[model samples]
Target: MNYRLLIQYDGTRYYGWQRQNSTDATIQGKIEVVLSRLEGRPVEIHGAGRTDAGVHALGQVANVHLTERPAEEIRNYLNRYLPEDIGIIEVKQVSERFHSRLNASEKVYVYRLATDPALHVFERKYMTPCEEPLDLGAMKEAAAYLVGEHDFQSFCTKKMKKSSVRKLEEIRLEQLLGEIRITYRGNGFLYNMVRILTGTLLEVGIGKLSPEDIPAILEAKERQKAGATAPAQGLCLKEVRY
Candidate 1:
């Protein structure tokens, strides 16, 4: 049977979602270890997205094939073995052909920024701290330019070999009590796309980049033209939509 899983993890310790030869301390590797033990054989699991190291996820999705087992038991069994930082939120049977990555229709990522000078010890792992005040209006204007479908080469990493053209369904910015939350909803995102976008928007918000310059920046398609990439800790995979 094909089972779909909803996962949540604090990626601070893991070496990203994909298994790595360098380190067995990965989200996928850890889960596969438990699954392999449970099935008494190799059990391959597929995730909806490969979140970068230090990035968190609240609603990550994955799928795996397993011999008939109670979904609730599987969830509880995995939780017993999986580390405290990683969890399986939900599990259910799915069509044999359903693939987590290929079947995803949309994804939402949010970046959190702490604008205060005094850092919260607990939030240090989840938010990026910015001491400077940001111009929210300017950031909003710059975000509007990025709403439609465009070649996001400027916002993507230069190492990306795939097509940079992607549809950005929405970019919402909200400030609450000194914490700035930037939400991105899109069909898909290139490598480090959200972090770069947040960095560029921060530049605009802090008077370093003009909101009017966004159009020209998009047209340039040069990675150097964009701002620095924000830290990975600030990014979170909020949800994956099918």
Candidate 2:
């Protein structure tokens, strides 16, 4: 039977979502160990996204084939044995054809920046502290340039043999109290793409780069032309829509 899992993890301590040969401290690795023990065979969890180290997920989805069993049993076993940072929010019997990654139609990622640290106490761990007071108007202008279909090779750090062209449908920047949440909705994103976009937007906010420079940067197709990749802690996989 194939089971679908709704997952949420802090990702502060783990290496990332994917299972690594080097360490068993990954989110997927830890969950697989417990499920493998319960089923008396090796179990694999296929996640929707491979988030980088220190990145988090609020509504991550995954699928795994397991022995015929109650979905609640699997969820209970995972939550009871999995580490405190990881939690199985929901589990359901799914079709064998369901694949979390391949079936995903849109991914929503949000980057949180603390405009003032003292005001945001509870969400500090998930947010990145930005001591500088950013120019909100400038940042929004810069974000506008990033929306739409574009080849975002300049925003990605990894060298991929496949195409880097992506359809970035929206970029919403919202400021609430002392935190600024920047949401990126797209068909897909490259590795570190959101973070790099955040960093480049910050540069525009701080007057390091102008909003008009966005076109040239995109046209460059060089990683060096973009801004630094923002810290991983600020990023969170908000949702995966099928």
Candidate 3:
């Protein structure tokens, strides 16, 4: 049976979602180990997206083929065996063709910044601290150029080979008491794309880049043309939509 899983994890303790032989401390590696033991064979997990190390996920989705069992039982068993940081929120039988990555239609990521570093000391692990006050209006204006479909090679990993074209559906900025949240909804994202975009927008917020620079950055399609990739701790996969 193919089982679909809703997963949440704190990526701080592990590598990215994909399993690796180098380190067994990955979220996928740990879950696969437990599931493999349950079936008396090796198991593989297909994640909707692979987050960078130190990132977090609130609605990561994955699928695995397993022997028939109650979904709740599987969830409980995995939860009991897996580390406390990795959690299975839901598990259920899915279509044999249902795939977490290929079938995904949208992904939502949130990048949080503690604009007032002194205020969120304890929450530092979940957010990036920016002691400098940002120009919220400037950031918003710069974000406008980012909405809609575009080739994002400038905002992704420098060594990308696949097409960098992606449809970025939305870029919403919200300010809480002392935090700034940058939320991105897109059909998909290139490696390090969201973080790079955040850093570029932040540069605009700090007067380093004008909003007009966005068009040139996009046209250049050069990684150096964009700002630095933000720290992984500030990034979280908020949801995967089907």
Candidate 4:
């Protein structure tokens, strides 16, 4: 049977979503290890996307195939066996044709920036603190240029196997409590695209870059011209929809 899982995790405790040979652990590697132990065999799990270290996800999706267990019982098995930081929220039988990555229609990511003077140390692990007040007006104006299809080469790192051009469905900024939230909805994202975009918009909010300059940066198609990549701690995978 093939099963789909909705997972929530604190990425600060792991290297990232994908497995690697390094000493640092990863979310997928840990889950695969536990599942492998239970099934008395190896198992491969696929996630909707790869999140960076120190990031968090409220709605990460993954899929696995197994022959020994029923689909519903796999959730219980994972819950009982997996560590507390990672939890399988839901599990369902998916069509054999369904693939987490290929069938994905849209993805949403949110980047948080804390603007309060009174920093919460506990929350710092989950959010990026920017003591400098951000101008929401400027941020919104800059974000306006991000919506629609364009070549996001300047926003991403690494040369992609596919084209850098992508369709951005929505981009907006919202203030919640002491934090500034930047939400982006798109068909897909390139490596570090959202983080780089967030940092550039923050610069615009702080008077370092003007909204007018965004078009020119896009024209340049150079990664260095964009804003610095923000730390991964403030990034979260909000949702993946098919």
Positional deviation of residue 208's Cα in model 3 after best superposition, in angstroms: 0.9
Best candidate (score: TM-score): 2
In the range 177-236, model 4's lDDT, one tens digit per residue, is 788888999999999999999999989989999998999999888999999999999999
The 10 consecutive residues of candidate 2 with the worst lDDT sum are 115-124
| Model 3, runs deviating above 4 Å | none
- Best candidate (score: lDDT): 2
State the lDDT of candidate 1 residue by residue for 50-142, as single tens digits.
998899999999999999989998999999999999999999999999999999999999999988736566788899998798999999999
Q: Write the per-residue lDDT of candidate 3 for residues 1-242, one digit (tens) a residue.
A: 99999999998888888888899988889999999999999899899998888889999999999999999999999999999999999998999999999999999999999988788888788999887989999999989999999999999886677788999899999999889999999999998899999999999999999998999999999999999899999999999999
Q: Estimate the lDDT of model 3.
A: 0.93
Question: What is the number of backbone collisions in each predicted candidate, taken in the order shown?
Answer: 0, 0, 0, 0
Q: Is candidate 1 or candidate 4 better by TM-score?
A: 1
Q: Give the Cα-based TM-score of candidate 1 against the true structure.
A: 0.96
TM-score of 4: 0.95
- Is 2 or 4 the stronger prediction by lDDT? 2
Q: What is the lDDT of residue 229 in candidate 2?
A: 93
RMSD of 3: 1.0
